[model samples]
Target: MRGKYTIKEINRIPELLKKGKEYKITYDKDKKYTFIGCGSSYNLGLITTKMLNKNGYKSNVISGGEVIVFDKVPQTDIGIFISRTGESTETVKAVENFKKRKIKTIGITCTADTTLTKVCDETYIFEFANEESVVMTGSFVYILNFLLNGIKKIDIIKDAETVLSKIKEQIDTIDLKKYNHYVFLGYEEEYGISKEGALKIQEMAIQNVEYHEPLEYRHGPKSILNEHTLVVINSKDTKKEAKLAEELKNMEAEVILIGKGKDIDIPYNNGYETPLRMILPQYLGYKKALIEGYDPDQPRNLTKSVILD
Candidate 1:
C-alpha cells in the first residue's frame, strides 16, 4: 500500500482505465483540441499527445492556464485538464475562462467534485488515494496507465495487460539500493519514459539522478558515470539497444536495461507496455527512497500541484 500497490490495487487499474475510455473524444475529431496537464500531469499530457497522434488523433500539450489565458484558443477547441487536486490556480482559471465562453472541456483528476470536474463537460476521476505525500506516486502511474488502456485500441488491451503483469514481476525482482545514483537512458520511443522515470527518482528518492537518451549520454552525461552510478536504459526494443548496454558495461557502469534494449545483466523485462511498464524500476526506487528515510510520497518543497497565477 505504501511503496507499490497491492495486487488488488494493481488489478483495479484496468477499471480506472476503462472509465477514462468512456470520455474518448468522439465529438472533436475535426475540431482543434489540446491537452492541458499541469505539473506532473504535463508529462502525462506529453505521453497522451504522442499516443493520440500515433492513433490518428490530432492533439498537442500546452499549459492549461496558458492555453486559456494567453493563447487565443479557438471556440471549437476542447480542453483536457489534469491535476491531482483539481485546485491549481492556472488550471482553475483556464477552466473558468473556457466556461465563460461555453467551450467544451474534460477534467481528469482524483477528486470528482473539484472545480475543474464541476465545470468540464466530462470528468474521469482516478479516485486513488495514493496521495498524502507531496510528490505523486501511485496516482501518477495509475492515471497514466488508465489513459493508455482507455485510449488504446481494444485489441491491444490484452497485450497491455501482459505488459502490466510483466511490470509487476520485474518490480518484484529489482534490487534498488545496490547503486547510489541512477542515470536513466533511453532513445526514440522510450525517451519520454526515461524523462518521467528520472523525475520519479528525483521526486521519490531525492538522490542524484539524471536522464538522457543513449546517444546523449555518450555526448556528455557519460563523464559523470562510475560503478556507483546505476545506469537505467530504456529502449523501445531491448534487443536493438544491447550494444549500447554493452558499451555502458564496458565502462564499468552498473547497467539495467528496460524496454526494447538488452545487454549485460540488470534486466527488467515486462513486455511493451509503454510508460506503465516503465513504472517498474521507478516503483522500486520509491521503495528504496522510503527505506533510506525519505518519504516518496512527500519530497521536500513539493506540493500536489502548482497554483501559478
Candidate 2:
C-alpha cells in the first residue's frame, strides 16, 4: 500500500533538519520567554520551554487560545509564536497581544510571506521544511531543532536514516492489530514528546491513546493495561524507568522502550535527541493506519491547519 504525504514528510525530516542547520537564530538569555501556539506547535512549545528552564533560562509555554480568549499572556520580555501555516488565527492574534504588551515577539513557521510574519517583531521562516501533508511531520522536527539550536548548539544526528531503518524493522515485527490502546510515557521534555507521540497515533490510526509522566502512570493509569495495550516509554535510561518497562511487560502489555539498550535504543543525550526519537511514533502511526485501512494523510474530520474565524 502506498502511504501518502505522512510517510513522505516523515522521510524528509533528516534533510529538512540538516537544511535548518545553516540558519542562525538569535535569542536573549536575559529576557523572560513565552512560547505560544496550537496543537503540535503548542506541544513543541512545551518541549522547548522544558529545555529552556532546565538550562537556566526562564521560559513558559501557553496555548494561543489562552492568550487570545482569556488574555492569559504571561509576563515575559520575549514571546515566540509557532504555527506551521503561520495563518492560525489564535496564534497570529496571540503574537499581536504580545506586541501590544511591548514584548519582543518572534514568529516561527515553515511558510514565508504569511500573516504571522506581518504581526511579529521578527520571523524565522524555514520554507524548505514545509510539508504538503496536513499533519505536521518533518517541519515539526525542523522548527523544534532550529529553536533548540538557537538556545545552545545542537548536533543534528547524522544517522537519522539508520535510526529510521531500525524503527521500520521494529514496526514490522509488531502485530499492530492486536493492540487497541496505546500509551506514551516520559519525563520533562520527554513528557512533551510522549504527548506528541500519542497525538500521532490518535491522528493517523484513530487509536485510543494516552500520555503521562513515566512515574505518574502507576498512580491510576496502569490499571487498564492488558495484553491488548501497547505501552511506549520514552525513557531517560534510568533504573526506575527500566523497571517500569519490565513491570509493564510482565503484566502482559507489549512495551517498546526508546532509550539506551531498550527495544528501540536511541542514545539519550539529555533530551537533545528528542527529534530523532519522534521518528518511532511517526512511523508506527503510519503503519498502524495502514493496518486499520485508513489514509494517514487525510485523517477523518481534520485539516492541515486549524484556521479559525
Candidate 3:
C-alpha cells in the first residue's frame, strides 16, 4: 500500500469532516490568541489566525520551535498548540513556556490521550481523522474546518467532492516529469493555503516549489517562470489576481486558479472555502509521487510525529 494510504486518506476527507468534533470550548472575543504548530499544523494555525483576526478576534501564530529554542512567545491570553499526533516534542514542551507566562492553553490533535492532552488546559482530539501516513492530509482539512466552521453546516464535504472529481482529470493528464518547478499564490488566509499546497508537492514529489502573494511573484520570482513551471493561484476573486494568472499563462507556465468560475468552481468565499482548495494540490502531489515511483505513504526523512530528545 505504497500510495494506497495517501489516496485513501485524501479521498476520505469528507468523511473525516463529517466526524469532526463541534466547537464546545468557550472563547473570549476580547482576548488575544496565539496558535502554535509545525508544518501542516502550523499552516492550519496560520489560516485560522487570519480568519480569527479578520473576524474581529485578536489572534496571532507562532511555531513551537520558536518557543522552545528562543523562548519567544507572543504575549497572548491563549496559546493554542496543534499537532496531528498530539506528541510533537517541540509543541508538547513549548506548552510549559506559555503556562509559565500564566497564559491559558489549548491543544488540538487527531490522537487522544497523548502528551498534548495531558499538558494543555484543554485538548481537542479528532480521533476520527487519525491517519497512518506520515504526511498530514485529510486530518489537516478536518482540523481546519473544525476551527473555522465548528461543525457548522458549511457543506465542505460537497465542495471537496466537486474539487477531487474535477482535479483528477486535470492532474492525471499532466506529465509530472516535465514540471520541475511549482509555485503557489494567494493572499491573506489563502496564503496559508498556498503554503500548505506547496508543502504537499514538496513532501510527496520532492519538487522545488515556492509560494508567494500574487503580486509578489511579479517582483523577482517571475524570472523563474517557464514552461516547466506550474503555478497554482488560490485567488481572492480579485481582478489583479486574475490578471496575474493570465500573465503567468502568457509566460507559458501552467496555471491553476481556484476561485469563482475559475479552474476550480469553489470561490475564495473570503477564505472560508480555502479548505476545499487543499484537495487539488493533495491529489496532484499523490499523482506526481506515483509518477516519480516513490511511495506516497512514506515520504523521505519524515515521521508521523517529531519527538525530539
Candidate 4:
C-alpha cells in the first residue's frame, strides 16, 4: 500500500473539494454530537471535532471502546466515527450504540463494506489502496481530505487543494535520507498532527523522534539538538519559528518550519488557512518514509486497527 494514491488519485482532491461544497448544505444542524474512533482513528476523531466546532456545530469525543463506560452519551445529532478499515470492533460497537439511541451517525472509513459503514446512517469512503501493513498511510491522508473538503465553512478547500498539490510536487523531488532523527513541534490543535508525524517516523523509519509543544520544547526538549536531528516546527509566526530555528542552529539541528510568516528559511514553505495546514507534515513524512525503504502499508508490529474490549 506504499504510494497507494497515484498522482491522479491524489489530484482528485480538487473535485472532492467541489463535491464537499455541494454537499455541505445537506448538513445544517447545529446541535451537539460525539465522535468515536480508536488509535489513529481517534486522532482523526480529535481533528473532526475541531472541524465540527469551526462549522458552528458542538461536538465531543469518547474512546470507541469506552463509550459505554463513559458519561451519559449525547442525544445523537451528528455522530462522526473514523476508522481506516471499517471492521474495528470498538468503533462498530459505538456505532451500534449510537443507532440504538436514535442518534444521527456519519461514518468516515476506507472500506465500503466494513461494520462501521453498515451501521452508520451516512458514510464517506476514501478509495485508498489496500494497506498490507498494520500501520496506515494513504488512508489517513484520504480521511484528512474528506474532513478538509467536507467542512463547508472556513471555506478554503480550493486553497488546501492547491497547497496539497504543491506539497505533492515538493514531495516527489525531495531527498529525505539525510536525516536520522526528527523532532516535531506544534502548538494547540496542530500538536496532534505533530504527534502523528512523529509516530509515522517511529513506526516506519524506525527512527527516533519526539512531538512537543513549541513552547514546551524550550523548557527541556531542546537538549537533544544535533545535526542528526531534524527539528520540524509547525507555527503560524515565521519570525517566532525563526527564533526557534536559530536555537536549533546553535545546537546544530536541521530545522523545517511549516505555516504562515517568514521567520525561518523553511523547506517546502506554503501557506494554508486554518488547522488543515497541520496535515502537510504527515504527507511530507510519509514520502520520506517511502524513500527510506520502509513500507508504511505495514509498520513493523501494528494492526489494521486497535480493538479493545
Best by lDDT: 2
- Give stretches of model 2 more than 4 Å off: none
Name the weakest run of 10 consecutive residues (lDDT summed) in model 2: 154-163
Model 1, 76-150: lDDT tens digits are 477778888888777777776666777778888888687778778888776653455566555666666666554
Per-residue lDDT for 13-70 in model 4, tens only? 4454455443332344567777788877787666666656656767677778787556
TM-score of every candidate relative to the true structure: 0.77, 0.97, 0.96, 0.75
Task: Estimate the lDDT of model 1.
Answer: 0.64
Query: For residue 58, what is the lDDT in candidate 3?
Result: 87
Q: State the lDDT of candidate 3 residue by residue for 1-309, as single tens digits.
A: 578999999989877766664545444687999999998989999998898888778889999999999999898999999999999999999999999999999999888889999999988888888998888988888778778873233667777777778888778777878898999999999999999999999999899999999999999999978999999999988999899999999999999888889887777676778778898889988888888888888999889899988
User: In candidate 2, what are the lDDT values of residues 56-152, reduced to their tens digit?
Assistant: 8899999999898888889999898999999998999888778877899988898899999888888988888888777788887777777788778
Candidate number achieving the greatest TM-score relative to the actual structure = 2
- Flag clash pairs in model 3: none
Score candidate 2 by TM-score against the native. 0.97
Candidate 1 RMSD computed on C-alpha atoms after optimal superposition onto the true structure: 4.4
Q: What is the lDDT of residue 38 in candidate 4?
A: 82
Candidate 2, clashing residue pairs? none
